[model samples]
Target: MSDADLPFTAALYASTRTEELAPLPWPEEAKRMFLAQQHAAQHAHYQQHYRGMEAWIVEHGGAAIGRLYLHDMPGEIRIVDISLIPEARGQGIGAALLHDLFAQARLRERRVTIHVEKNNPARTLYARLGFTILDDDRGAYDLWEWRAAA
Candidate 1:
């Protein structure tokens, strides 16, 4: 995403963050403050750590719905992050994006990898899409990988 896209992309990020915070018992204002701070920190972390990260603002029918961050290297395409607003959830968007990523991986002959929290519902989708756990030693998150059949 470009500098100009930051404002809208951040809004998209905030929507996803709101969903994440939904289960907490905190007040609305507290959630708002926490999300704002967390977004800034996460953005900075991505910028500083992944110099060549490819960030995309996922859009549907002219409206921004989510964000995708990827890090492409020699033999792997790492999905640093992918998040959608609550309204966009369960709408097949994430699966479509994964299929597109898989196509890219097939063309490039590289494996696709992503880290998903162990209890995250999306882990089921990843598994259904043929991503197998590569590592689960990192506590909450498991590293998953998918490669085309030879």
Candidate 2:
């Protein structure tokens, strides 16, 4: 569907297949590809688990500005990662993106869960959205979850 069809004021979400993100527009950390390649065997591992994947792209005024990745599960949808370009940070764009995400999840009666890097500022934003830290390991990071308070 076209961005114009999205009811959200700022962003549109398009759910798609995992293979579709093979050549993503996202920036990768240095050596990230090499590391992923080194564990190529694990590629199949992930692909098998998340057989269905969807990439969320945030656009504004016809310009692509952000992205997020997710996969549907038997009882939930997992938000793997999300990022917005530096220029768009702190513009209420992320919250709007997440608000739409939660609305979609709640409509389906599924909880929203995500992993947050300890140093990432988005954790603060997620907290404001009612996500609570579920687990933490100093070096690895933490898990946060938000359930509809029924």
Candidate 3:
């Protein structure tokens, strides 16, 4: 993602967390402010930990729709994060993207991994795509991995 995509990327981040934030009783402006701060922090953390990671802007109909962050390591391709705007979700865009990533991973014989919230709905899709829980700390997130069969 480029500097031009920052606003849309922030909005996509907020959309992903909207359901969790809905019951917080914060005013809309306050929520937006918090989301912006959180997005900045997360972005910084990812950049610090996964320097040179690949970032992609998911587009549909010539408009930006989402963001995909990836880190390709020697043995695994880590999905740092993926978020879509509310209007663009549940339309198979995410699945298609994952399938494409899986194809690439298969070609390189590398495992694909992601850390997802325990209750995130996308976990179901990852399961359907053959990802298995590689580590679960019983915390907010679990590490999942997928490998193409021999």
Q: Sort by lDDT, best first.
A: 3, 1, 2
- How far out, in Å, is residue 61 in model 3? 1.2
Task: Work out the TM-score per prediction.
Answer: 0.90, 0.67, 0.96
lDDT value, residue 114 of candidate 1:
92
Q: How far off is residue 86 in model 1, in Å?
A: 1.3
Report lDDT (CA) for all predictions.
0.88, 0.66, 0.92
Cand. 3 Cα-lDDT: 0.92
**Per-residue lDDT of 39 in model 1:** 76
Model 1 per-residue lDDT at 27: 94
RMSD to the hidden true structure, all candidates: 1.7, 9.2, 1.0
Q: What is residue 32's positional error in candidate 1, in angstroms?
A: 0.7
Ranking by TM-score: 3, 1, 2
Q: Which stretches of candidate 1 lie over 4 Å from their true place?
A: 17-25
Query: Which residue pairs show collisions in model 2?
Result: none
Residue-by-residue lDDT tens digits, candidate 3, 12-84: 8888889899999899999999999998998889989999999999999999988999998999999999888
Show pairs that collide, candidate 1: none
Per-residue error (Å), model 2, residue 55? 1.2
